[model samples]
Target chain A: MSVLDEVLSANEAYAASFDKGGLALPPARGFAILTCMDARLDPAKYAGLSEGDAHVIRNAGGRASDDAIRSLVISYKLLGTSEWFVIHHTDCGMEFFTDEVITGLLANSLETAALGDDGFYDVGTGPGSDHGQHIDWLTISDQTQAVVDDVVRIKEHPLVPPRIPVHGFLYDVRTGRLIEVPVPSDESAA
Target chain B: MSVLDEVLSANEAYAASFDKGGLALPPARGFAILTCMDARLDPAKYAGLSEGDAHVIRNAGGRASDDAIRSLVISYKLLGTSEWFVIHHTDCGMEFFTDEVITGLLANSLETAALGDDGFYDVGTGPGSDHGQHIDWLTISDQTQAVVDDVVRIKEHPLVPPRIPVHGFLYDVRTGRLIEVPVPSDESAA
Candidate 1:
């Protein structure tokens, strides 16, 4: 069976015992989490969120990209969330390659790249686009710094309110732990 | 306790028993899922995903915004995901308002809005920005259509490989079921 079929069948079991249908549109916990799309980091599990608990915005590196900020803005401005967390994880795929490297790979071909001991190398032939060159890819060199940068970016965004406290953390995929990344005291104070 | 403190406490328990430290960086399931930031939808639970199972990109409405496409591109181009799913859920907060309404609310005040019988209304005083006016917000008028649109957008993206199949599904928030949103046969065939 396809992964889609498998998940659909799983959903059947999930729905069989589903009872939390009346959750309010607004997050009951009054918070939002911005994190990576990495499959290993389950925001609901790590963050202890139940249905109707919080909004979770995720992307490549969980960076504070414009789209992510837009989601955060809506999460608070419209959905009544008062707090936010920006989480990036250890062993994140984003940290494995830079924008130039990924773009170079994409420019070669749109097929999957193989990761050897050294790093990723393209395996496909022909039919590639330079479109990836235009994207930042939000690659991460430092996990803690990436989390801090995202937190600061979200905290400093024009659309984000000063009242909301944004926290930064790194989730350890191995141990399933969230380690806080401290923003500068002055920055947090300001 | 603050939500942060509470979640951290919960994390201790999750970490204590965590034994999946050996999972690889790339998703083992060889697929990706783009879904909404809705608090009610647990993509892991609904999709039956374990650690390192699949890439899951999420945003306000799970709409295929450029950033989402960027993540999906990286998911396939770099990580080897062969299939993708665009899963938007029922009763999403994005369906509660239009782009204009959200930007209008943001323009009035950057504080949290209240949801009453009429819909969202700003209750905070002063200091708002028109920055939101520039954002797309990607609000949903119809859930199934949004899923179909996202799937089509991902499939037709310049960076996405044509060989990868993108599936569209609407997750019923009430039942925890994923109902397939059939793409027009020609669209999928193309």
Candidate 2:
């Protein structure tokens, strides 16, 4: 079965575990998670969550910026979210890349978009051939300070309530388990 | 109340609602998503997902290259998932960036850790920034195409299964309503 198929199959089994739940289904007795779009990793296997329980959001390195925070504001204020889970893993591509390069490239490319080299840019098949090589700056190989910083960013974020719990976890690509990192509580002076 | 306070308060109510379900344990839920690191967009409110339901993930237009995909696969497969939601808003920032400038800038700055400035480098934030961007080529602005392509990619992915049922959505920042995009039964056709 393909990755989607396995998830579906697992979802069926997972859903079967709790068809009609207590009260109103706990809203997110199931959840929607936002993580990176990396192909080699599997979420349900790592986060200890299963199908029929959560929603998964995959983007790059699962970074929570103004935009994602905006969505979080909505997901909680309007959607009824209770907990916050942010996972930044080891050997992440996010570690190696940089913003200036990306945005700058766009600015340059757009400036020259209408013209090839100088006009009619090639939007199709970008940069290199591998399509697999991640920018070095984008990759976060270690799971320490980065995870803490992200968690702190989430917890202290003015957008989120100081008390709204935000967690930081590490999903070891090789092992497929999300290890929760020790983060200072939102109330911590440090 | 701050965004977190607002969410926590609502979570208290949401959690109270859960008490009747017998799970009765929490004052809050999980995960708040910050995307793009782009301030102009909203993912959940626009995607139609209920508030307090799930965390949001934002980066460069929600592209799931091998790196991001690997993390998601694990988050879903192991952590547990039932819904896989994509909240790509109109006029995304991913539409503005590229791989060239990203690689070039990084290699020049960290010139030592060169991944070759001329290839398919994924640009993003500097070390510890956790701000991730995307490769210009793989990301698409067309909602229909992006959604269909993502769903198909997730569904047909060799690593995932067919039954996973990936869903696509467009969030209109103006409307604040999650517009569900239709995925062709076989969106992979294109």
The TM-scores of all predictions, comma-separated, are 0.96, 0.40
Tell me how far the alpha carbon of residue B5 in candidate 2 is from the true structure, in angstroms, after superposition. 24
Kindly list the per-residue Cα lDDT of model 1 for residues A1-190, writing each as its tens digit. 9777898888889999999888877888999999999878888888888888889999998989999998888888777899889888898888888888988888888788887776547446768888988888899898888887788778778888788889889999888899989999666534
Per-residue lDDT, model 1, residue B94, is: 82
TM-score, candidate 1, is 0.96
lDDT of 1 by residue, B1-190 (tens): 9888988998898888888888888888999999989888889888888878999999999989999998888888778899988899888888888888877877878877787776547556768788887888888898888887788777777888779888888888878888889999666534
Question: Model 1's chain B TM-score?
Answer: 0.95
lDDT of 2 by residue, A113-135 (tens): 12134423233222312212233
Supply the TM-score for candidate 2: 0.40
lDDT (CA) per prediction = 0.85, 0.43
Q: Between which residue pairs do clashes occur in model 1?
A: none
DockQ winner among the candidates? 1
Q: Which stretches of candidate 2 lie over 4 Å from their true place?
A: A1-26, A30-34, A100-142, A185-190, B1-190
